[model samples]
Target: MPRLLGVDIPADRPTIISLTYLYGVGEKTARELCHKAGVNPQARARDLQEDEVARIAALLDKDYTVEGQLRRQVSQNISRLRDIASYRGMRHRRGLPVRGQRTKTNARTRKGPKKTVAGKKGVKDLR
Candidate 1:
């Protein structure tokens, strides 16, 4: 594994794919980083020279927000929303779907497992 910006990238993968192992880096950004760093995107990560790794790391530090920095920035944004009492912030605070997804069904991912309430007894139970 090649360590870049404190993250270990898989050595078996192509440089482009390896770069995506970092938080906030996707295919498009990885491609762009390879281009700007003058590194071969198709080259295996293990084959990259020290200079090439330094170049990519320098470029990321200078031009991108990623990893812990990106995570903190996102959390700050959500916290700000919550502080301001925004609807989206409320959803985040409440752990509900924030993108207007209907909660009537299929929101199990956000809503978590069902908390079933006991059913009411029928009229026959009263007799």
Candidate 2:
């Protein structure tokens, strides 16, 4: 395992794929990082030399906000929306869909489990 930005990247995977394990780094960003660091994207993480790892880490630290920082920034954005009481914020407050997704049928993931309601009793039961 190679440690980068406090995350351990899988050793057996190619450098391009392994770099994506770090938060805020997707496929394109990983490739760009490899290119900037002069590291071979096709090489396995386990095969990388210490200097190469250090170079990659240095590039990421200097040029990007990743991991904890990225997570905090995103959460802050959502909080700001909530504070402003926007339509989307209201949806978040209510735990409903915020992106115009219909709640009539397919929002089980956001709406949670079904709550059963009692149906009308039969005439025999009324007696």
Candidate 3:
């Protein structure tokens, strides 16, 4: 395993694939970073030289907000929305879908397990 930007990437994978193990780094970004660092994208992570790993780490540190920092930033953004009382924020605060999806059905993922409501008794039983 090669550690890059505090994440241990799989050594057996190609550099491009391994780089995606870092948060906020996708396939396109990985390829671009490899190109910028003058590294072979097809090369395996374990095969990379120390200087190459250093170069990739340096590039990430200089230009990208990832992992903890990115997570914090996203949390802050949601908190800001909540403080402002936005509709989306309210949805988030309520633990419901924030994208205007109908809650009547198919929101099980956001709403969690169903809570069964007892049906009303028959009119004859009310006498």
Q: Which lDDT value does model 2 have at 55?
A: 95
RMSD of each predicted structure: 3.2, 4.1, 3.6
For candidate 2, what is the TM-score?
Answer: 0.80
10 residues in a row with least lDDT, candidate 3: 118-127
- Model 3, position 123, has a per-residue lDDT of 48
In candidate 3, stretches whose alpha carbon ends up further than 4 angstroms from where it belongs are 111-127
Q: List the residue pairs that clash in candidate 2.
A: none
After superposition, which runs of candidate 2 have C-alpha atoms over 4 Å from their true positions?
110-127
Please say which candidate is ahead in TM-score: 1 or 2: 1
On TM-score, the leading prediction is 1
Error of 2 at 101 (Å): 2.1
What TM-score goes with each of the models? 0.83, 0.80, 0.81
Q: Give model 2's clash tally.
A: 0
Looking at model 2, residue 62 earns an lDDT score of: 91
> What is candidate 2's lDDT per residue for 40-117, written digit by digit as tens?
999999999999999999988899999988999998988899999999888988778889999998899987786565
lDDT per residue for candidate 1 within 7-105, as digits (tens), equals 999999999999999999999999999999999999999999999999999999999999989999999999999999999999998889999999988
Quality of model 1 by C-alpha lDDT: 0.94
